[model samples]
Target: MRKEVFVAEQRVPEDLEYDEFDAGALHVLAVREDGVALGTGRLLYGEAAVGRTGGDPSVGSLGRLAVRKDARGLGVGVELVRGIEAAARGLGLAAVDLHAQTSASGFYERLGYAGYGDEFHEAGIAHRAMRRSL
Candidate 1:
């Protein structure tokens, strides 16, 4: 389902969808009651996640968050973010950061993330930096 959203529906280049960080990151998969992957997200900690926000050692960066189109509005995204936050807290992280697509900033803001920097383009889409303390 993550591949469907991040790779196919969003047209994100395949290489960017998966990277060296996977092996080191803690991934959370949201599956259906029937046992299918409905959505996914990752919590990055330690040195590997440093570059996510220009080397902010105290922050855990949430990345590669994707919910299947069919799963939209099913509360999957909310659960995924909360799961990532739980993982971050387990790792002793003080905060969490993410490059939220501009369209989703409000969604994240309601989840407690605060926009912190100028908007920029990523994968041809507008994005803004957002953060929330764990």
Candidate 2:
């Protein structure tokens, strides 16, 4: 579902859609009872995550979060985020950070992430940096 949304639908440039960090990052997939992926997210820890979270060693970076368009408003994204946070907690991380599309900052704020940085363009879309302590 994430590939469909982040890559195909959103056209997030294939090169940027995936990277070397994937090998070491923890990936979380949201699926239905029958095993269909509804959404997906990933957590970057240690050195590989520095750039994504502004070099905060105690923080894990959450990225590649995407939900199937059909699954929007069904809470799949919430579960995907919870799963990523759980992964961060398991790794002894103290917080999580993400570059959220500005339009979706409210959604992340509602989930406990606080936006702090000036808005910027990422992949040609307005974005804001947000953080949440575990």
Per-residue lDDT of candidate 2, residues 25-133 (tens digit): 8989888899988888989999988888888788999998999898999999999999999989999999999999988999999999999969998777798999999
List TM-scores for all candidates, in order: 0.95, 0.95
70-131 per-residue lDDT for model 1 (tens digits): 88999999999999999899888999999999999998999999998799988788999999
Give all candidates' CA lDDT scores: 0.90, 0.90
Candidate 1 similarity to native, TM-score: 0.95
| Cα deviation of 59, candidate 1, in Å | 0.5
- Model 2 alpha-carbon miss at residue 33, Å: 1.0
Question: Quick one: RMSD of model 2?
Answer: 1.0
Error of 1 at 107 (Å): 0.9
